[model samples]
Target: MSHPAAELIARSNRLGSDARNTNYAGGNTSAAGTETDPVTGQDVELLWVKGSGGDLGTLRQEGLAVLRLDRMRALVDVYPGVEREDEMVEAFDYCLHGKGGAAPSIDTAMHGLVDAAHVDHLHPDSGIALATAADGAALTRECFGDRVVWVPWRRPGFQLGLDIAEIKQQNPQAIGCVLGGHGITAWGATSAECEENSLMIIRTAEQFIAARTAELEAQGTHPFGPIRDEYAALPEAERRAKAAALAPVIRGLASTDAPQLGHFTDSEVVLDFLAREKLAPLAELGTSCPDHFLRTKVKPLVVDLPADAPVEEVVARLTELHQAYREDYAAYYERHATPDSPALRGADPAIVLVPGVGMFSFGRTKQTARVAGEFYINAINVMRGAEAISTYTPIEESEKFRIEYWALEEAKLQRMPRPKPLATRVALVTGGASGIGKATAERLAAEGACVVVADLDLGKAQAVAEELGGADVAIGVQTDVTSEAQVQEAIAAAALAFGGVDLVVNNAGLSLSKSLLETTVKDWDLQHEVMARGSFLVAREAARVMIAQGLGGDIIYISSKNSVFAGPNNIAYSATKADQAHQVRLLAAELGEHGIRVNGINPDGVVRGSGIFAGGWGAQRAKVYGVDESELGQYYAGRTLLKKEVLPEHVAAAVFALTGPDLVQTTGLHVPVDSGVAAAFLR
Candidate 1:
């Protein structure tokens, strides 16, 4: 790349793409290069730095903050002392080359004040493990032998940047240094050399941690303490089964302030950490790196109970633990808050740990939740290394609280875009691969709900899910709703993928238009089994999840007009529809106390884009109505009060309307989306 900004981006992506180098949006890179001044036509030095909140792994030109090196470095002349360092961030805007590029971050000063042409600030877990050690400064001296210096713990700001600059000037041979209780920063004469230095720091830290761990193991004094037999991970199937059961309960508890989407992990890193005897005390001390703290909160909610205990006992204990966690979090806020500090944003732990189960992380979106989990894994790595090398010692709680409640961070949070109507909600749609089910999946995904498209056709279901937005926003699960086990599996899949089910759409069905004389016993059983029994199975399983969540929920049944209207030659299908209609009433009355709203949509002959119609059911219905198959939709439209065909999208819209913010109080009510069919209207 000819431009300095492009070069910085290339360098940043190379460094940030690897988890060992840095995590998502957790590092900053800058390049000091010459660029011609637009107004003066003279060569001037410029600083191209990774901006605040931009992920270096996927960074673009717009994600870099371009600053006039002369102007940015000049801020030090009048540098307010460490007490007034936050004011320096605002000063950075005045040093910008133009009113473009991403906003400068807190580390801008660290990069600009340094004399090197290339600089990188990163939070590699291995590097941070050494940084948070009790003897970090002495350890840094021993590790690099003066080749890399150590900067003692200081909250990152302009002053910290100045301190690094002074250290660099004094030590000409140093390639980089570990920021005590923070991360690492490296500098070089060129971009390649800077990247090499960054990688060397990371690799060296990893090697040191590994060798030290082995040494400790040889001495029979490993960092995490002996593996507790009682805390050993359960079998994979049993562990995940327990996770699925506990997900809803954890999600509901975490959603006390605002509803949160969740992500679960049983990776070896997590399982190993949880299986150790020292897990509780180490977790309570909290993570060291600022990046880890931001995503994972100050500490986690550790489930201090037996992993193999009965589900009921475990659940009851979780409730007590959850209450204690909230109270402690509120106390932390109260102790640290100034009059101007933002109100306590939340009282829930973003990370939750269960011995023998794994980790659960919650956030406003799937990406956030998943990233939070990833960061906690990084934290585990950090804690392990710190314990192996020296006693793990994080920054003081006061310093952590100050940074956590920093006004600048609050402003960033406030600036985030408003969430969509169904944000943080997860939905499972049966038969979601096509027809009204497919339409509902798309609509819910568009409204910001994580969707699970469950259908018998796995390929089509996966395709629909991909179209909605892959694994992050949606996923596909092959399910035969008629089978109780399959229905349970589908619900479990949704719980595993995105915490718990907040809404479920029972739209999987097949119609058989046969006269009583023509319909055989086999045909009758199949229709009732797929439609009536299937809906019951799905509802029952989803209700278990919903009740466990204690967050209340929505279960919508796509019952048909045939449920109330007597359509000819439709015996089994019509009877199944009637069964579904009454189920809404029964479930609504029963589940109302749990805050679950059961509703139904009666759409009259949604022939266009419907799986039921495409699979030859339309031809049979057309023969009975005495109309050609091609004109069946028109025929159905003509019978309605309003001469408009009822398409699958109309039914999809009814499902959203019932579950969305607008109809929170409406339940056991069937909304007709058949373009005003008078005969099918509820009486």
Candidate 2:
């Protein structure tokens, strides 16, 4: 049977994948219970955000940051309108970044205001189709009708809140609203419901666009056209210079707390498209949708930096341009504000463009930029299509500002709180001082588990255990789990300290570089002793204690991907891990009678700054593999489906699943935490 968490994850994945496949840069899911707002000390559960810059496939619980809604509402009510907006943005950003969590999505306020159990935001291609058109609101209304409400495009931040509030007051039962020329937003009492609505909106938009495009094509009109020579001849040097100058300015506008900056310049096609005169009028018309304003911004900033300008000079000019823009923005705000209006909340720009360089969408978070980039790319295509049909007509400028600056829209910035899933568990991990083991230890502790760290490095183990600061909860047990006596002592100490052993994670193992043919008996025995014998010894001993207490517990073996897949030089290590996997199955089969569960979590090469794949897998080892040192990690990462290195914490989550109530009926199972590398090798 599938675990509930696993089922939720599987379904969540489908939603996230569909969003990205449709051209959205990213998507997120958030949760909350009644929580006290950190800023206002009010009683309300702040929803948890999945955060920016994260892909759903690898996202774990830690990625979701909490925000206290009551506190947020208090801040909104207590502070000046302008100050409240800034505080909301700051508080949300702080909850995301300052709390050492992934940055929350820029539209967190939108999710908060929905007063729903779950929320999801995305920029689907179909949605972008109508959003990029001049008659987006009319088109959406004709298609979605009462199912969706249309919010005019706003720049985002404070303006977005203002717009959303207006819509809510008008339609109390509205499921969600689409921002003209921006993306779509959906909310529900559960994650499944939210996802369903999101899909409904996207599918509806797609079907509408498909039919409309087909009709146009039948009439001998195409949506997009090929780029002409005149539009494509922009110099690359000018583009490069433009990106160099804009990086810092873009970074500044995105976050006040984050001083770090990295720039990814655009492709030639993107730069060429931005250089067109049609770009200005199209941008003034508004975004493909309003929510997209938080991602791509209402429009891209056109830089006129010359190709011959020095990189430094170009950067300086970009900074100056942003300053001028901000001053002009203040003037625009003063000109438009009424007694009821709130001033601008954040400095994030819609999009920044250098004459020859590509565009950058500055938002409160990376997810914002990511989604905006997706919308921008789609919008570019829309413009090309529009040129094919007639110059792309988009929503009006004033409406865009209204949506961007909506009060209710800005309210989406708050986040909700969630309970730790592993709050009462006690975890004992072997090899917990360094590498994958250390990372796993940290993860378990962070999830509210009492962790006993056992390692060969007594000092490191003691330090980590002590740092955890729960004398009764965390302890350092220096023991080579390969020795039955040592393993028993560690198990005994855990029972004595934490009351009982709830989990035993056998993660102690080491790698050797010798090939199967060249392997020595000594090396073979060493691997067997630590990987196979040690795991069995620890599991049996822990199982005995768990059985006595009459509380079924979890015994997890940290196996390796090599256990299932054969490779040239990993014979000794692979054979031992393979045995460990079998041991787990046997333990689960036998110990289930005793109410003890056994499982395994197999991990791929967990190399990132870890002992396993560090130093190019070490120069000496690389020489034996007959590959360059630099190619070692890449060679491994390249083999994975997602091209992402499997981290130790990824394996820890598998351990959590194997041990948690979610997998109560599951036993003797092996979960491959590899990035589909096993399947790749099998194929």
Off-target runs (Cα >4 Å) in candidate 2 are 1-13, 19-28, 33-46, 52-58, 69-79, 82-84, 91-106, 158-173, 225-375, 382-683
What is the TM-score of candidate 2? 0.40
- Structure candidate 1, residue pairs in collision: none
- Weakest lDDT window of 10 consecutive positions for candidate 2: 254-263
lDDT of 1 by residue, 1-683 (tens): 46667777898898889999998889899999997898999998999898889799999988888899899988989787888889999999999996648999999999999989999999999899999999998888878788889999998889988999999999999999999999999999988899899999999989988999999989998699988888889999999999999899999999999899999999998998998989999999998788889889999999888778777888898899999999999999999899999899999989999888989999999999999999999999899999999989999899889889998899889989999999999999999999999999999999999999999999999999999989999999999998999999999889889999999999999988999999999989998899899999999999999998989999999999999998799999999999999999999999999999999999999888889999989999999999999999999999888899988888888999999999899989988888877777788
Worst 10 contiguous positions by lDDT, candidate 1? 1-10
lDDT of 2 by residue, 1-683 (tens): 44323433554567766543245435556655554446666665556666655566555666666665665544445445644565556566544322636566556676666566676666665665565566667776888887788877655555465567567657867777776555677767666687788788887766666676678778875454333333343465544433433343455443332211122437654666655655556655545455455456556655555445566676667667767766665665666666766667644455666555566654322334445555676667656543442346565655556655666545554343343555545578999887777777777777767788998778888888887764634778898978898887787556444434667889988767678788899989988998888888888777765654444578888887777887667788889988998898788889888777888887887766465556333564567667787676676678788887676778877777777658788888888888888552422
- Model 1 segments more than 4 A misplaced: none
Task: Pick the TM-score winner.
Answer: 1
Counting only residues 3 or more apart in sequence or on different chains, how many pairs clash (N, Cα, C under 3 Å) in candidate 2? 56
